[model samples]
Target: MDIELYHDSKYGNGARVAEEFKRLAETKGSNVNIHHVREAGSKNLPRADLYVFGSPTHFGKATRGIMRFVKKLELPPGTKYAVFGTFSGAAPDKKTGKMPSEEELEKRRRTIPMIDEALRSKEMAKVAEMRFFVKPENLKGPLEDGWQKIVEEFVVAILGK
Candidate 1:
């Protein structure tokens, strides 16, 4: 399957994670394209069997650029999708003994439902499935080591890898 990961990161985390997603997406020998939303011109998103949108969460929602782009986009019939995002903050400390893995941390780096909720609210019922990720500050990455597994597994299922 062909995939395109279009993302916007005023904070650059979206693009960073998108790159990693691109790498994982291609591992299965599928054709995957990654684009930065900042450099995207117009809503003319690419043709892909699947779309993975990554954006920096804003006020617990997807970024304005992503929202505008999605608003203007009409997926080719039969398109499937997933979403990911990045944020800068410390989540409420959980008292659990298990520390969330790096990717899980990134997945929770920010809440993505704001964007997902808005998508449904805007009548985006075609999204076959949805998943999200969050990352921390300027360091190794929210995608550290274990994080890739979250998205990689999602891709394997979507693409049947």
Candidate 2:
């Protein structure tokens, strides 16, 4: 299967994750291509059997830039897709804490639901399956604990033999 990975990383970890995903996918036997969200603008992507979208979670949602980029991630009907994100927070609190992280106030005010909904129908109408991960922004992650299995499983299920 041909796979395309699109990502927007502020600290460039998003790209690193995209590269790791491509490497892993390649070992699994697929021709993979990764485009930095910025570079994605100049080139038209080839038709891919699978499409994975990722971004450094900024303010509880994908970056506005990434979200805009996702509008471009739109694929033909039935294209398979998945998603992942990175964020820094203790978790939501009952009272709005001072500074309210972007994920807290939701900078774009439409991060989670927008990406979730987009992956549901916009990016790929027939998502074989989907996945989400949260990592501390300052700590840097795409951590490889039990979480690795979650992503691997998502890929395996989507590419059922």
Candidate 3:
């Protein structure tokens, strides 16, 4: 399958994960292309059997650039797509030393739904979704431990292997 991963990264976390996804997809014998959202203009997106999107979670949603890209995206009806987000997990508040509540954590990981909605507007079929939490200490991350397994699972699911 021809796969394209278009991503926006802040602090490199999103790009890091996107690269891993690309590597994994390639290993599975699928032809995959990776593009930074800025580099892949909406008018010039390459043809692909599957479209993947990645972005760092910002203010509980995909970045404005990604949203705008999706809004202007031109894809055929029923195009297969997937979304991934690099999110910051809750850390203890400096003042109270308390972590965010479960609801807050869920809200903060809202990037997936927002991206999915945008893809849906283009009449795309979402095939997969993933959220890789970043380590809070450095802010920038090599994702949390066990990320390899997550990526592996995503590859399998997307490829239907």
Candidate 4:
């Protein structure tokens, strides 16, 4: 299997995930090519069995660069694709120290959903989706614990190994 992984990682969290995904997929006998979105333009994306896109959540949505890249993709209809995102989990209120409810966080976390919409609009088939949490206190993060395991599981799920 051949996989192309692209990421727009402002603070490196998404980049880290993409790197790990590539490493694991390669070990499983898949050919993986990884690129930053800026380096891999939409007009000339390499052909692959699957394309994986990753981005860090910005204001609850994918960064403008990533969104533009997804919008410009011209892959064949029904192309296999997957998405992943790095998000800062809800932080507690400074004064009250009260954390937002899961429901509220859901409303605020639309990074994956935004990418999914763009891919769906292009008629791409989604194989899987995932979100890795950044620590709430720091947006530019060391991702939450066990993120590597999560990425490994994601690679297995997508590669079917």
Candidate 5:
């Protein structure tokens, strides 16, 4: 399988996750190419068995660069794709000192959905979607522990090996 992975990483956390995904997919004998959105510029995206897009969450949505890239993608309809996002999950409530529930966080973070919407508009088929959390205290993260394992799972799911 051939895969093209594009990412918009302001602080490099998303890039790190994309690299891990690429490494895992390559181990399964799939060819994976990684590119930054700026480098790719949404033109003539190489054909691949699957396309994976990653973005860092900004104000609960995908960064402007990624949104623009996705909107400009010209891939044929019914193309296969997956998406992932890196976010600093909600911090503890100031009053209660308790972290927000996952349900609440899901409602607040729409990064993956934003990307998925653009892809769906172009009639692409989604294989999977995931979110990797950044440490709440450090938005430019050391990702939440075990993020590599999540990437491994994603690689297996998309590559089917």
Candidate 6:
């Protein structure tokens, strides 16, 4: 299958994950084209069997670049689509020493769904979705270790391998 994947990465975490996806998909016998969202422009993308988009979460949403790209995306009806996101999970309360509540978690998890919604708005069919949380190491992330395992799982799930 032909896969067209686009990503918006801040500090390179999202781009690294997208590259990993491309590598795994190619190993599974798929032709993949990966691009940064900014460079992709708002034109009609090349024909592909599957379309995948990913981005790092900034304030519980896909980065501005991704949102802008998705906003202008034009895709054929019923095109297979998937979404992924890298989030730096909820922060702890310094004073109370407590974790974020369920509601807060829900809010923080909205990035992928938001992207999925945008794709669906373009009449794309949703095939899969995933989220990978990165550890905040002064924003120089190594992707919280073992992130490749989840990437592999997502690739299998999305491609039916």
Candidate number achieving the greatest lDDT relative to the actual structure:
5
- Model 5 agreement with the true structure over 7-82: per-residue lDDT tens digits: 9999889999988887888888999999999888788888898999999988778999999999999999999999
What are the lDDT scores of the predictions, listed in order? Answer: 0.62, 0.62, 0.85, 0.89, 0.89, 0.85
The whole-model C-alpha lDDT of candidate 6 against the native structure comes to 0.85
- Give Cα distance to truth, residue 158, candidate 2, Å: 2.9
Per-model TM values vs. the true structure: 0.67, 0.68, 0.93, 0.96, 0.94, 0.93
- What is every candidate's alpha-carbon RMSD to the true fold? 5.5, 4.8, 1.3, 1.0, 1.3, 1.5
Q: List the residue pairs that clash in candidate 6.
A: none
Please give, for residues 45-160, the per-residue lDDT of candidate 6 as tens digits. 89899888998877777888998998898777798988998887556766897988989877866788888778778888999888887875344576888999999998998989
Per-residue lDDT for 36-147 in model 1, tens only? 7667754566767777777766564666887776666665544567776555444434577565667765554443665555455545433433344444434224443455
Give the per-residue Cα lDDT of candidate 4 at 9: 95
Which regions in candidate 6 have their CA more than 4 angstroms from the true location? 136-140
lDDT of model number 5: 0.89
Model 1 CA lDDT for position 18: 66
Residues 1-161 of candidate 3 have per-residue lDDT tens digits of 89988888978877877778888888889988888888778876788999999888887888998888888998888999988888886798879999989997888788889988888888999998887888787667767888878888888889987
Best of the two (4, 5) by lDDT: 5
Residue-level lDDT of model 2, residues 1-161, one tens digit each, is 89877778766655655666666667788887887777776236678877777776655466877778766554666667766665453444447644556554455344445666765665455454343344533346544345555556656765663
Worst 10 residues of 4 by lDDT: 38-47
Instruction: Say which candidate scores most in TM-score.
Output: 4
TM-score of 4: 0.96
Look at candidate 2 and tell me the lDDT of residue 126. Answer: 46
Q: Model 1 clash tally?
A: 6
